[model samples]
Target: MQPNAESVVVLDFETTGLSPDQGDRAIEIGAVRLQNGVITERFQQLMDPGRRISPFIEEYTGITNAMLADAAPVSQVMAEFADFIGDDNLVAHNASFDKRFLDAEFARISRSYPGEFACSLLVSRRLYQDCPNHKLGTLVRWKNITGEGSFHRALYDAEMTAYLWLAMLADIREQSQLELVPFELVTELSKTAKKSVGAFFSRW
Candidate 1:
């Protein structure tokens, strides 16, 4: 049988700003590895981005400049993260943002992952179109997923995204009546158009 929610990494990043091209950098990263629909391992680290973060970012993520003062350098952290990844497929709430930073940071360390990324946000949008919005927090509430802690912090957000991913997988399996939902199916569903979503599932 193909791997379902049994093996993958859900990741989140706290960044200094939006775009790396605009000199932004990831200040922290959090990821959790799932096996058999449960998290079996975790990776979290705060990196020193070698510059002062904007007051807004500091306020937003609650990762102060003071906290980053003595943290490991981005290159060092990225190298360790590359090892932690180790060919695992990745998931993120809004994956493009995290993927961009992952790529940028990997480039700095001359490292890359062969695994693909699946965005929980995209899959949720298709599965839960009636949701008020697709933001991580919104979906957590909309699905009644157990949300015990805070958001914005890399580890906390990654944890929440992990649970949300599991919830979506369960829903898809129950609704689609499939014994297993492959990573490829989730990736394909993310690309399926809204209007064609029902047809997409029907054909599956």
Candidate 2:
């Protein structure tokens, strides 16, 4: 996949807790579909996890227990989200967390997606080592990415992640003199040593 030339979905999830394997479920899901570097579609949903959210999680995400009282169940929302993601590559800030919830929720619905997942967090650690930190809010401010919503909420975080993804692609294109940034290059950069990163791109 040429990340700069094709459709990609940037996604974020606000969960009832941290670990999906430990019974934490997604309380909210927010995603944006980007095509050719422009956001073309958006998805956001609040789901009831059939369990009560703790005070810590509620305060952290600003999503109250009452807010989820009438929300849809995980199975229904996951089905729709799976459809929204149809065959497009997926990006998330910390993808392992999101991927766990996605896999668990999809398994409950007997659904699956074929797209590869990328972590903007891992990529940012490689691309912007000078930044004080690689947190979503920090990178958003450091990169001057516009954000329309509050932090810890799914939608706004997803928007910021989309902008970060674009900035990294722009950086690579500028540094490598490439017309388009390939998906493989971004993933490779995430794993490549910082000292040899520039040379690795030149070899590409």
RMSD of 1: 1.1
* Per-prediction TM-score: 0.97, 0.96
Q: Per-residue lDDT for 158-192 in model 2, tens only?
A: 98899899998888788878887777777778888
Q: Give the clash count for each candidate.
A: 0, 0
What value of lDDT does candidate 2 attain over all alpha carbons?
0.88
lDDT for each candidate structure: 0.91, 0.88
Q: Write the per-residue lDDT of candidate 1 for residues 1-204, one digit (tens) a residue.
A: 655755899999999999998889999999999987888999999999999999999889998999999999999999999999997889999999999999999998899999899999999999999998999999988878775667999999999999999989998887778888899889999999999887887877
Would you list the clashing residue pairs of candidate 1? none
Which one is best on lDDT? 1
